[model samples]
Target chain A: MSVLVFIDHSAGQIKKSSLEALCYGAALAASTGTTAEGILLGTVSQDLSELGCYGIGKIHQVASDTLNNLDARVFSTVLAEAVRSTGANIIVFSNNLSGKAIAPRLSARLKAGLVSGAIDLPQVANGFTVRKTVFSGKAFANVSIHTEIKIITLNQNAFPLTAGQGTAQVIPLDIKAAAPDVKTVSATQSSGQVPLTEAEIVVSGGRGLKGPENWGMVEELARVLGAATACSRPVADAHWRPHNEHVGQTGIAIAPNLYIAIGISGAIQHLAGVNRSKVIVVINQDPEAPFFKAADYGIVGDAFVVVPKIIEAVKQLKGVA
Target chain B: MKILVCISKTPDTTAKIAFKDNNTKFVAEGVQWIINPYDEWYALVRAIELKEKDPATILHLVCVGLPDADPVIRKALALGGDEAIRVNADSQDSYYIAAQIAAVAREGNYDLIFTGKETIDYNGASIGGMVSELLDLPFISLATKFELAGSLATVTREIEGGEQTEQVGLPLVVSCQKGMAEQRIPNMKGIMGARSRPLKVVEPVTADTLTSVVSFELPPAKAGVKLVSADNPAELVRLLHEEAKVF
Candidate 1:
């Protein structure tokens, strides 16, 4: 049985998360004595052979314009057919927006066991057991899939990418595709800012910044640090930032490497989403702010005073004006 | 319009998580249970708002769990759901839960189904998509904003660096998160009314579970905070560069 990894792309380029998934699937294939292959649904600009360095042997490309925009049902049907024809028992996907949308439906269609948010490779010595984060990154659960076909979606940035010198053979697959049930009307493009979910470093602000007018320092720090900008729920709720920028239990959950929170009280809801960050830094005037307890490094000071110095330090460190 | 809101009971956000039985099971003793924040704060609240907008809307609450999950269902009804359905299944497998939900949705012929993006406990985020596929309905996952006008519904969902707005017909499923609606606290009258609302306990459909839990483990704890005085903010950067090595 071979391992099939879903390679997701946007604007004709493969997403970084897909590379992580590719590495994870390759490692799993190596451990299980199976070949690692990939399936691409839409047209991509990247040379399929170059991705061979990630250890994938072959890539099945379905160049359908309709596949460009993700439709969970349509994608599931295509993937189910691919799995049937390829005899791939293990499927892998990145547990991102598209993965979350498609993996579960695909699981239903294939009647396969699925483990989403998997953080580790399966323990295959005795049985195929996968470990995943649950309770909003509070704990891990080891799930054993007994189904003939099993699926796993890896969390973003969970696996390290290992590169090897190699080339992959690309083959085209022809399949009957269906029109999507849902129709897209419009899309608001995000600016050049880093994607919060995929960003390695993030600078977040809460109500402590006081209002939207005081957001300049937060943006400056984020720019200097080369980090994405995020906010607590209250800031978003109060319309100081767009709802999409909110990062918390009720908002987008992110686990960047460096999460710098300025003037934000660390609420449990907020922690549920960001507790997985590699290192947390909090800057607040109140020393008793609960965020300090969860942070690796903390500064008890006013945001107005603390953020500029951090930004200046970053600029000086990076040799920028 | 008929809507089915899916809910689950989860440990409170601050609950001290512990595993028992050699880490084979999650310890429930002395744990405070509440309606999953996402379910109560987003999906159910949005369904209630839609019902308020149009009196013709009928809201139903569904959960796949044992009898102990009834209180969670009651809380949903108290928050404005008209009726509730509890599928007596103990398995936390998404396939099993989706099978049970699909059966009920088929029996009820509900037009719109809403579920939280994922339960906080399992964080599987799979049931809505699985159930939609099972029922052969359109599935929209991680919908932040949902609005209905006549038979067509408009939705806005998040992408990596952007957002996409889409439109779909009725009889679809959506996994909801923030921006859909605000939270609703159950008032005295609503709580009183929930006590009388009918909660039907149904049997689950026969389905094979694809996965089983081998164990539950906790993530490594964070080291105590290392404070860097705000006056010397450059030192914080030094530690991040020299020690944390994140930059």
Candidate 2:
């Protein structure tokens, strides 16, 4: 049996997380002594063969316009059919927005075991077991999949994206597309910003920023550092930032290469979301802020004064005016 | 309209997380449990708002847990659910839990189904999709806004870069998140009323437990933080560049 990776794309562009998923699937397939193949449901503008650099040997494409927008029910139906036709025993997905919507449905359709938020490769020498984050990254669990057909959704940024030399053979799969019951009324795309999930660096602020008007410094620092801007729950609740920017246990959980928290007290709920970052930097006025304990570096300072200096320093380092 | 909102009980957000039984089980001792925030703040509250608009809307709460989870279910009922159902099973398997919810939904003939995007404990973000698939119904996940007119539902859900608004027919499932509705605390009157509300305990339908936890591990403790003088922002930047190499 072969391993199948769901190559998720939006507006004809493949997501960065899917690249990691492809790499992960390829490695898993190699370990199991089987080839890794990719399944693309919607049409994309990029050359599908180029994706082979990520180690996939083949791509099963169902190029249909109707499959472009996410309709979990319709997508799952098509994927389930593909899995049966391709004889794929292990399915891989990047646990992003689209994957989160679709993977569990696929598992149910196939009666396969699913482990979402998987952080590492499965151990196959013994029974197949996958390590995944539980309790919102506070704890980890090694879950064994008993079902013959297994499914896993890899956490974004958890797996490194490795590219090597290969060309994927693109084979068109003939499968009738299901008419989507969910009609897309409209879409408002966030343009000209690195999406939080895919961002390598994130600069977040809490109530210490004081108000929405003072967000200029935060944005300036983020812009200079080429990082995405995020916020704490209180800031989002107070309308200092949009709810989408909230990153915490109750909000979006992000694991970036570097996460800078300004003015945040680092409540347990807040730490639960961002504890997985590779390195954390905390800048706050209060020395007793709980965030300092979890941080890799701490600067006890006022956001108004410290942020602008950091911005200037970053700009100087990047040779940006 | 009949709405079924799935609720889950999880450890309190501030509870001390630890393991028992050689790290195979979560330490439940002295751990206070609460209704998962996503379920209480978004899913059930949105259903309550809908019921407020349409007086005839029947709101039913469902949970897959043992009797220990009853208090959480009762709290959900106090929040606004007219009735509640608890599947008497204490399993951590998401597939089996979804199967139990699907069984209840199939028998109830619900017009709308709501679930939080994910539980605070496992953070699986899985149940709604699995339940919808098992029931063969359209599923909209991470819905931030939901509006219903007749049998057509207009839902706005969060995507990777932005937001997308879509319309679906009734008898669909939705996983609610922030912006769907504000969190509501049960009033004394509501809490008293919940005492008399019908709480049904039903036997779980047999479903395969596809996965089992072999072991648990806590994240490694962080090394002590390296403090920098507030006036020395440049030094901090240099350290991040040279030491962390994050840039």
Candidate 3:
């Protein structure tokens, strides 16, 4: 049995989350006495040999420009073929936007038991049991996969990355790529913005920031820290921020390394999305704020008075002008 | 056009979460349940908006669970669904739930099948994709905007650092999120009208669940917050940089 990790890339470079998935898959393969292999669907600019440092023995490249647009059906079909050709019993993907789109379809197509948002490797002593976060990160569930071939999507930053001195053998994967029924119309992209889903440090604001005009400090803090900017649902609804920047149960759920919530009253809807962050900092004036219950650190202060100082301190720490 | 909006009953957003049966089961007693926010604000509401634009379009609601989920179905109908179907089964397994929904959609011949990005209770965003694959139909997940014209449908979905707009023919599946539509509350008239609407209960399609839950556990409670006095705001920064190590 072999383990295959899907390498999701954009603009010729591999994603940080994909590297986490590779390390997780490689460790699982080692624990099971199997070799880890990787599959790259679209054309890549990075050398395939760099993947060997993550413990992958072989790298399968299906170099095609058509695969770059990220049609879920086409990707799943191509990935299913690669899995079959590589004799992989277990397939792994980072639970990002691309993985979320393709993993379920691949699971249904290959009749493989799938566990998305898995937090840890599976236990092999008995049947393969995977631990995953459920109920919007409020609870954990141990799910046992009973299928012959298993598929797992690891949550971003859930595993440690191992960099070793090695290189993998790259091979060409031959497969019949079919066009999806869905046709692309147009793409409106915001270039150079860190995606909220993949952000390590996120500085978010809410209605307490008062209005869109006062958002400069939040953005400044984010800029100084090289973090992504997010907003609460109310802020997005009131047009203080774009809908894509909203983070909550009804919005985009994110799990970053450091989540700095400024001026946002910690509502349950918002907490469900960001509670998985490794460190949480809530900056609100009210001591009774519900968000303080979940925060690793808290500050009782006014956002207008507090954010500027925080941004200045960040600049000082980074020695930026 | 016929649209079937998938809905799920979940614990209220503020419900205090706890486990029972030695942490194997969720405690449901005393907890109020509501229609999942994504389903209400995006999938079901978008379908309602479509119906309002074109009166000929029919909106139906489907849920996979026991009778306890009917109230959530009724809530959907009052908001705008014309009818409802409750598949009598436990929805803990996403694969089995998708199979049942696929069976219902096949018989109903829905032109459009819509679901939320995922259910809040399980956070398993797998049903729509699995159902689409099972029925051999095209699926789009997390569509922010869906517009239908004749036989073609335009779906705008958010991707990494961008938004992707795609066009697909009818008889496609989509899971929606925010930006699709605004939330609609049921008026008294609509609530009374929903009481008279048709709610059909159908048996589930027999299938082996690929994954079974062994147990459930609450996430470890966060440590007590170390409050930094607001008088010295820079102190918060120092804490984040030193003790927290977030930077």
Candidate 4:
């Protein structure tokens, strides 16, 4: 029996979270005395063989044009069948949108013990136990799964990717496709420089930005750093930024590597989503902002002046003209 | 359109978070329990919107709690819900709560189930997903906006750095978030009307629980903030590199 890793893709390219999940699954498989394989659904344009560097021995590609879109039920059904066919004893996924939708259903279907938001490798001393964040990253919980098959959804940025010199065997798999009951009529997207969830660095603005017109510096800095842009809930509600850019308790919960908050007094609601960041930097002229209490680093400054200078310096550092 | 909106009764946001006599349980003395704020935004408001589109639509507010939560359930009824259901059971675990809701959904023959992305109290975003699994239906979490037309529902969810639009068929579960609708306060007329609406309290069937919380504790306090001079932006950057090691 082997460990199965689900590779997430969008716009015909694989996601960085998938690579992290692949490495996590590979490491878990090694500890469990089993081999790790990967499954790629939909039509991917990337070189599937290159995934071998993460220690994946083979890739099962379900190359169907219809599979490009997401239908949780359909995806769960197809993935369950794939697991049975491959004799995979453990299933792994990135603790993401698709993973959140599919893993629970798959767990119930297969009667396998499941865990999400797993932050570390499983402890196999006596029984298989995995560590996960609970209470909105406020604390950690150790959960032990006592099923014949195990499933885990790794949190984003929780595990680092491993690179090595090897080529993985890309073996295509034949699976039955189910008809999706849902159809997309129109999709409205927010055009931006960085994808917030995938960005290594995030530059967020809050009420301190003052008005929508003053957002240029935040965008310029994010652009220079190749980081995604985010806003506190109040900023989004005021329409300074689109609703999709809102990151907080009521908004999108994120766990990027570096999170920089500007002009924002961190509320408990706002902190719930971003407290998981590896390093948090708060920039607010008010030295007493609550955000500074939780920030790993704090800079007392005015965004209007400090942001422009930071952007210019970043551009100069990156030599991006 | 029949919509089932689920709300959880919890302590008010302003309530002081603390432990009880032995620092094991949440302090509940004199704490006012209100409908979870997130659920009100994502579920109740969206349900009202659906009702406005189709006046014939049936909107039911549901909760799994004891009799003391009836006032909050009545408050939900006053907020335009035609009916309310009290499961008469404490939501001890996610699995048990999901089983109770799944049973109710099956019996009601509801087409769509709506809940907050996660309850502020338990914060177990698990029920909606688990309920969908038990009911054998599609589930979507953290939907910023959703539109239902011609038996197909399209939902947009915020992902890490980006957003994704998903289309799913009818008879699905959706966990609503901000942007679904603005919070609505109950008017005097609605409050009077709620007095006569049907509020049913039923006992919950015993469900097999797979997990239990052995203890609870508060998160450790964050370290004190280190202030950096704003005059030298370069100094701040240097400190991030040499001291914080984050750069």
Q: Pick the candidate with the highest TM-score.
A: 2
The value of fnat for model 2 is 0.87
Candidate 4 TM-score restricted to chain A: 0.96
Instruction: Kindly report which residue stretches of model 1 are placed more than 4 angstroms away from their true locations once superposed.
Output: none
Model 4 gets an lDDT of 0.81
Q: What is the C-alpha lDDT of each candidate?
A: 0.91, 0.94, 0.89, 0.81
> In candidate 2, what are the lDDT values of residues A1-321, reduced to their tens digit?
999999999988999999999999999998999999999998999999999999999999998889988999999999999999999999999999999999999999999999999999999999999999989989999999999999999999999998999999999998998789899999987788888888999999999988899999888888888899999999999988989999999999999999999999999999999999999999999999999999999999887998899998998999997
lDDT score, candidate 2, position A188: 88
| Candidate 2 residue runs with Cα over 4 Å from true position | none
Residues B54-103 of candidate 2: C-alpha lDDT, one tens digit per residue: 99999999999999999888888888988999999988889999999999
Instruction: Give the Cα-based TM-score of candidate 2 against the true structure.
Output: 0.99
Ranking by lDDT: 2, 1, 3, 4
Give lDDT tens digits, candidate 3, residues A1-321.
899999999878899899999999999999999999999988888999889999989999998888877877788889988988899999999998888888998998898999999999899999999999888888899998999999999998788777987899999998878987888899887777788888899999988888999989988888898899999999999988999999987788888889999988898889989989999999998888899999988888888888888878778888996
User: For candidate 1, what is the DockQ-based docking class?
Assistant: high
Question: Please, what is the TM-score per model?
Answer: 0.98, 0.99, 0.98, 0.91
Cα error, candidate 4, residue B128 (Å): 3.2
**After TM-score superposition, what is the CA distance of residue A308 in candidate 3 from its true location, in Å?**
1.4
Q: Compared with the true structure, what per-residue lDDT tens digits does model 1 show for residues A215-262?
A: 999888888887999999899989999988998876887878899999
Cα RMSD for candidates in order: 1.3, 0.7, 1.3, 2.8
Name the candidate that leads on lDDT.
2
TM-score between model 3 and native: 0.98
Fnat of each prediction, in sequence = 0.89, 0.87, 0.75, 0.36
